[model samples]
Target: MSPPDRKEAEVRRMLDGPHPLVPPGLGLRAAVRGRRLLLWRRRLGLAGWLLFLAAVAFTVWAVTQQPWIPPPSRTTPPLEGW
Candidate 1:
């Protein structure tokens, strides 16, 4: 037989064979893992939003306060003459 036909026959034979055994608890374990993954993703998303808000708040405060400018002198300059 041709290589293609041989491959097809081999595949058909494998499909006709009995299926492998699966663990009884596989579905329960998968469900628990899926729930944990969803919770972790939600927590990560909330933390990302909180960090973004904090950064925006800090930027706004800095702009309004203008902390870079020096404070005014407390006392007046000395007299020019005695």
Candidate 2:
């Protein structure tokens, strides 16, 4: 037989066989796992936003205080020809 005929015969054989079996409670387990994953994803997104906000707040505080710049001296410079 040609390729097409062979394929058709294989398909007919498969169709004539009994249906495949599935384990009980598989759908319930899948749904529960899906829900848990969605909740975890939501929590991660919230955490990312919180970290971003904290970084922005810290940057603003640092810029305003500018602790890296040294304080000016209190005393005046000595006279050149005193």
Candidate 3:
């Protein structure tokens, strides 16, 4: 039989007549298919690339950001003994 028919049979067997747990056009092997897609994308170097660069840039900017307090406060001492 064709792939879709085979998948339908397997899905039917999995659900034991189908109630509501299965999504449309998805079978019991959806997780396997999803993992395959993720692997293919990773192999093609198409995963989280933009996110990686954005994270690196954010780190650098955060490291170089000026301190919250002003320069005068940096060396000022407490007035406890005054």
Candidate 4:
């Protein structure tokens, strides 16, 4: 094709915008939508994150709140001192 025709075609393509899911379209939209759906389903993602945090907190609390216990060897007699 002629130079002018080619340039015109290029400009037209640039202005035509991209196709979705199959061509040069905004794939980011799909990703964003997926994220939004996830957030929506999970109640704005905050609840999910808070739940995760709560699980971690519960685990830590359970571990740390336990009473201390000495080693078995320390609590046991040393074989009647040989």
Which candidate number would show the highest lDDT if scored against the true structure? 1
Model 3: ten consecutive residues of lowest lDDT: 66-75
* TM match of model 2 to true structure: 0.65
Q: Which is the leading candidate under TM-score?
A: 1
Indicate the residue-level lDDT of 10 in model 1: 94
Query: Which digits, one per residue and each the tens of the lDDT, describe model 1 over residues 1-82?
Result: 5466888899999999998999999999999999999999999999999999999999999999988998899999999978
Alpha-carbon lDDT of model 2: 0.94
- lDDT per residue (tens digit) for residues 23-55 in model 3: 676764787899999999896675578778889
lDDT of 2 by residue, 1-82 (tens): 5466888899999999998888999999999999999999999999999999999999999999888999898999988996
- Shift of residue 71 alpha carbon in model 1, Å: 2.1
**What is the descending TM-score order?**
1, 2, 4, 3
- How well does each candidate superpose onto the true structure, as a TM-score? 0.77, 0.65, 0.29, 0.31
Model 3 / residue 16 / CA error / Å: 34
If ranked by lDDT, best first, what sequence of candidates would result? 1, 2, 4, 3
Q: Please report how far candidate 2 places residue 20 from its true position, in Å.
A: 2.1
| Residue ranges of candidate 4 with Cα displaced over 4 Å | 1-44, 67-82
Off by over 4 Å in 3: 1-47, 66-82
Model 4 clash tally? 0
How many steric overlaps are in each model, in order?
Answer: 0, 0, 0, 0
